[model samples]
Target: MATNKPQTSRQQKHLAVLIDADNAPAAIVEGLFEEIAKYGIASVKRIYGDWTQPNLGGWKKVLLDHSIQPMQQFAYTKGKNATDSSLIIDAMDLLYTRRFDGFCLVSSDSDFTRLAVRLREEGLTVYGFGEQKTPKPFVSACDKFIYTEILRADAVEPAPEPATAPVNGASQEAKPATAPVKAQKVPVDFIAKVLDDIADDEDDWVQLGAVGSNISKLSPAFDPRLYGFKKLSELIKAQPKRFELEARGSNTTGGKDLYVRNRKPGK
Candidate 1:
């Protein structure tokens, strides 16, 4: 009998971080990396913009610091945005290559909304990050959408001016500068679709894995990474009042586990 050799398994999560320098702030580039680091190793980091424009001056410095490849697109028309077209074409090309596990799209523009949806249709994760002003279409297009303002990259809260009232004049002490209120912009439509899909199933409370699968079916570019959560469990946990979790059973294969879910509050 000949000795049998065990084959080695190759596994790794490869991520691509593509930035629309025109729509994103250079100040948040480092913070973007910090967010992407939690997902998986970023094998490719590229920023798309017109190098000739002075608007991209800040991006030039950050690109050198982060080793991000700069893709320069010239203006083909006076008023039309050419960079967006170039980036979308490149994204489609990369999708066809099928090399990356996920893509991080750092832009607030809704123009890439279709691109995000298309990538997910091909079974690739998409992480979207932008300012709070990002449109509903773009936000809902991703598996998870994040607002960069919450990260507080540039804005620093100043200390409140002390009260000038005499010690005897005021009995109450002055309050220091309270932290800014961070809004949790819930993807109501997306969440509703997921819940509805799960409810439609034979089991009212479907497995979390199944919910995620349904979400991907509904939107291919869905990724939990963009929401400052590495795993779906964490994202759902953060919205406890919106979701309920239950342990269904243990796994006997490949070290995978299972669970069930519930609706968000007021739903």
Candidate 2:
């Protein structure tokens, strides 16, 4: 897994994390924090559920270790989840505070679809974490949605090939681990659509960062991991036949910016 890029104080995002214990598994807690670290600091981490229920008993120790606050909501009625309401209410309260730059909603339930959309409407970025079974509505509602299944990569993803030195300009990056979900078939058409939508034929050299941002907007659940790569640049680089990668000294701070262009025929 790639680590979070170093960010200045201004670039760092303060995020409020809200997890639906009823819908998420306890096993993902470790990987969840690691993944969340990539986006921003967890200013507030809270999980919601009925603590009295034995079904959520597995989460007890995990919460203490992560220092995550547990918000309790009783089962007001059979077959009804009051926890959802509790989480939504608390989320709005946090939103109004205007302290967080984003919200991390961890749940596999589709019920939070409106909640995600509402948060984005308030100009707050919403990052969703859920299982693959999560509905399209919920996934599309967030700014970015990560499937929890990838969090448990070791057990699910096949071992990667040995690493070699990276190439300059057009990177021949090391291959990522094979996914059990078979998402390795690169999203060629999707990439083409995003390129066409963002860059015209004359604008061949589009910054990779801008391309990535648009990809998230068009497909919130689109992740490089799904295509068996750790980063978008690598995913694009892997497709030498379809795309051309360029690295421009790009930043004053000595960071190179990667650029992409659709591979022209016979070149």
Candidate 3:
């Protein structure tokens, strides 16, 4: 039977990456770009911050390596954040150009929530990168939200071995500045619910890809990496007790189509 399927080979998207240097840490820059590449070509990369400040020194060091143009926005007032304003203005200007397929906003500040919504209203995808502490409004505003903690763990260069130093009047090795943080456990209930909702009948086979899409819709911040799995399929396969998997046909992505079903009480 002839089937109507969308093209498996997704066209490379053009993205405008805008970074809020004050809100985004420099440690995640390498990983940030790597993640962006997965979505599309970074047609424009610009960061907004006060360059003269010493705190942003780390970002300056990586500017040349990544070819990111720094947009200087000096702090004009004591409490006001001029960088956010500058970035938002530039984002709107870039939106009107109509050249980009999407926008990647790197910041944890909630101030960009409205900006993200405005851009999406114009039909551009918004990918937000922020820390775990990022406001839910901003996180929910983007089409996809990636926590920077993951990026730091994945891409930041590891620090050198610590030298012996005096501690509490005795010579001892200094402890590591960054201790490894454990990933949160996968939301099994959420996955089970999505699978059941999609299934036409009990034990009916459902496309894994469809379940993945529904999960994303329910939780934009849902990433298999959070649970230490590289892919959705890997995560599902790990929980064999609750789900059954079957392969029926080949797909365009050079991989076989995987169908999933809710496991019955027995066999």
lDDT of each: 0.72, 0.87, 0.87
Candidates 2 and 3, the one with greater TM-score = 3
The TM-score between candidate 1 and the true structure equals: 0.61
Residues 73-189 of candidate 3 have per-residue lDDT tens digits of 988998788999999999999999999899999999999999999999998889999998999999999989998888877722334344656778886755542333356777888
> Which residue pairs of candidate 3 clash?
none
Per-residue lDDT of 154 in model 3: 72
Which RMSD values do the candidates have, in order?
A: 7.6, 9.7, 4.8
lDDT of 2 by residue, 1-267 (tens): 988977545238899999999999887888899888988899999999999989998799788899999999998999999999999999999999999999999999999999999999999999999999999999999999998878856333434535566667677754442224445577888897788778855867788889998989899998888777888898899899999999987597788988898888899
Q: Which stretches of candidate 1 lie over 4 Å from their true place?
A: 1-11, 154-267
Candidates by TM-score, descending order: 3, 2, 1
Q: In angstroms, how far off is 237's CA in candidate 2?
A: 1.3
Per-candidate total of colliding backbone pairs: 5, 0, 0
TM-score of 2: 0.85
Best first by lDDT, ranked: 2, 3, 1
Q: List the lowest-lDDT window of 10 residues for candidate 1.
A: 176-185
lDDT for position 244 in model 1: 70
